[model samples]
Target: MPTTIKEKTVLKFEPVHLSDLTKITDLYFSQTGIEKENTNFEQPKLTEEFGFPIYKLVEGNLIIGYSYFTVNSSEEIVFKAIIKPEYSFGDLESRFINQSKQKYLSKKELDRKGMKNSIMRMVDWLNWSR
Candidate 1:
């Protein structure tokens, strides 16, 4: 029998397990949409050894979402986050990110190299209108 989490509960962050990759990928595609036929959705290499720490959001035993982030100095740079649509609610993403920041701050060292890159370096990718 398949178990589902239909009610909102206290959520916690846990390391993204190998078995959770499929669920994460499905959520990503579902939210982002597959606009192109050749859109190659590669699973991230979840590890802090390479500076990216990925976590799965769980309430009880069910995985509801996953976040990928890197800590640069005191800042946590979130590369991607995807939650099951049913669980997506106002402030949920921000709260999850803040929780991730707290967890990573205590568990890993900040990336000094990432800190060296300034916002100006990413000007081309930013929209001034926004």
Candidate 2:
């Protein structure tokens, strides 16, 4: 395990393109493993691409994780997140989440709700699996 999360690692959040789904699926399966006792998450389907927005969390040139979320009546509900095993430390997760929140809060289209009142439901999938 890393002794400490990389200091001020510049994280970039980018939308996942159709071409990226294969990589996402591969990583998800690798991280979740194939044990029968492990929680089984539905494999992402291409037909359901329009259902939610997925963002890949990047540090420099490497893609460390990905998150998919949908907005409900009261809050932004994060359906799932898959982070690489090596970069799954709490500090990195916290930083990524905070940045994601800020990105959503700053969206001009969501101004009607007022950023302060916007709610975000975070799911720590890595720990939740254990």
Residue 33 Cα positional deviation in candidate 1, in Å, after optimal superposition: 1.0
Task: Please give, for residues 17-122, the per-residue lDDT of candidate 2 as tens digits.
Answer: 7566556655655666633233566433222222233578877867778765444556544444677977788776666656665665566355423322331211
Candidate 1 yields a Cα-based lDDT of 0.58
Residues 7-116, model 1: lDDT tens digits:
65797788876566556555555666633134465333222312232688887888888776544455655444678888889988777777776776687676645632
lDDT of 1 at 4: 89
Best by TM-score: 1
What lDDT does each candidate get? 0.58, 0.54
Could you report the Cα RMSD, in angstroms, for every candidate shown? 10.0, 10.0
Q: Per the 3 Å backbone cut-off, how many clashing residue pairs does candidate 1 have? A: 0
Best by lDDT: 1
Every model's TM-score: 0.54, 0.47
